[model samples]
Target: MSSVEEFRTAFRDWLRADLTGEFARLRGRGGPGREHEAFDERRAWERHMAAAGWTCVGWPKEYGGRGATLEQQVAFHEEYALADAPARVGHIGEQLLGPTLIAFGTPGQRERFLPRIVAVEELWCQGYSEPEAGSDLGGVRTRAELDGEEWTVTGQKTWTSLAHRSDWCFVVARTEPGSTRHQGLSYLLVPLDQPGVEVRPITQLTGTCEFNEVFFDSARTPAANIVGTPGEGWKVAVATLGFERGVSTLGQQVGFRRELEAVIDLARRNGAAEDPLIRDRIARAWIGLEIIRGNALRMLDGVSAGAPGPEASVGKIFWATWHRELGELAMDVHGAEGMLAAGEPYDLDDFQRLFLFSRADTIYAGSNEIQRNIIAERVLGLPKEARP
Candidate 1:
């Protein structure tokens, strides 16, 4: 209920005062590529945040949220990044699944799930991308079949972030026999601790296993676990995707800004800034970032009306491509020294990890190719690309 400025002032004051002691040591300890570092410590910090009612500030008050305004939410993210706080471990739950449930989940579902997320008592991972279905979500072949009182699920999901640490996975599975593409899919909240589930870490180019391959062979969730009607999960799944790109994107920009500033500092320290091309690229990165902010703000301003439309694809393409390019610039700033690992068995510095991991920026969530297709068909009314 507070005005944006009031909320911002209070949040900034609280953050400055509270991020000290053991928490002070945790600053900048966890993030995208560095998730494997200090996880237990970061988890404790998140619990401290939950104890302070600092988690999920934007959900509905009825659902144990602060019901914060859009401006207040944006301010929270900006300040959190300004403090260089660790990337949250509950992101998939708090940002993606919580909102999706609020919009699509039944009362029983909401009551069962929302409080756990707000408290960070249960961690969740996205079960969307598969080895064969990463970019083309409609290609998901994870099949769940309804039995007497449970749905038995069998499928493999790859690039599943933090699945190794997650207690549950929100899985999209083919639930109807003979159905194809986007039809007959169901979003099931499956517990990961069950015997039928297996999680194998996939070490990336950064030499960290923040992602996993989740194999579900006869995994079971109660039949009541489906979020929408059994066969209408594409709609539910797409809504979750929209949340994945929602207000959190603004916070992500704050991290991007921090990374950019660090890259600029690196260039100056290493004398890379003296090169004319390096200077030009840095300037272009700044300008592109400005354009990204403008597009993202405009997109968010319309939230009162509805969820983001297809034009959201524009923001996705812009930022992902921009970040991937910035990663290249990060390596370029390091020059020849960038080629060597910081040590043995995959010891990489921050810049090395940034350069390697950002390669996936354009590929995950939705690939650049898929985003272009969505824009052309849904946003521009262009002819759909010919499908085989």
Candidate 2:
């Protein structure tokens, strides 16, 4: 078999063999809008995967990964999704921070961090968005100051995913006293268990607290925890964002395919499929998914060459909008039933949760408006937008 095909088959077999008994119940658990579901169980399952050398397969062997090729990594994700494995609990660490560290971290930093990430010993969260700076990361006002051997971080980061559950946060703070915008920023890894850090969960439309606001009041990390040169943190931070759009998304697309299938089945059972209009929308949704796959593949080429460039925003825009629309389509398939909760006390069915949560897909991970601006200014050489 070709290497990619062989990799796919091996992972598919492993998942089929292992996802039974205690882990069997974890299938389809702990996803978007439902992150509160079986979170502890999912974390255990991820640690199990790590034990078997299944996690961080794309990292170089020296970093404790299997050094799987790009195509192999893609196959791994697709197979994992097809197996209905639980949502990964360590993705933020494995896909984003690990790769960034590999590219920019000091040897001592890599030595201390990479193995923990590979083994799922420490979970990490991004500390990029804040009350005043969501899409425009350059507007971040979080500040970090070096005092002796440690850096004290003081700022509030909103929309931090899973900060309550994470052990560390990669924070983008203004390190230069007078700096503004992207300049003079530093990416520091701060521990969440410290007394100075507080995590407050934010209730969402799905009635879940997958996102949180993290307050770092004089939080401290060793000065060595900073990634890249202190004044050039924007470069390191941008690299992490590029990694966020990496190959794991193919697995996400697989989950999306399954959701689409479920929606189609719902339509068939409820007689919505008989409506030609509904049928057209379903077909269009399918087409859009295919386009999303293509965009992701094209973006991966950029990743293989180096860190993904502005083109990664294209895939992000397409998939986020497509997912948001798919959620709308699911509600439409439900017709009037979509309006009501599945049970009393705000219980929501899968479709209801999907509709409510996918609403933010386009807004998070860089909004549609910001993405279009990236494509226009960076990809198409358009004139910059006016700013006050």
TM per candidate comes to 0.98, 0.98
Residue-level lDDT for 64 in candidate 2: 92
lDDT per residue (tens digit) for residues 285-320 in model 1: 999999999988988855544467778889999999
Give the per-residue Cα lDDT of candidate 1 at 44: 86
Q: What would the per-residue lDDT of candidate 2 be over residues 187-226, giving only the tens digit for each residue?
A: 9999999889999999999999999999999999998999
**Model 2 TM-score, 2 decimals:** 0.98
Alpha-carbon lDDT of model 1: 0.91
The lowest-lDDT stretch of 10 consecutive residues in candidate 2 is 1-10
Off by more than 4 A, model 1: none
Cα lDDT, model 2, residue 210: 94
Candidate 1 TM-score versus the reference: 0.98
lDDT (Cα atoms) of all candidates against the true structure: 0.91, 0.94
RMSD of each: 1.1, 1.1
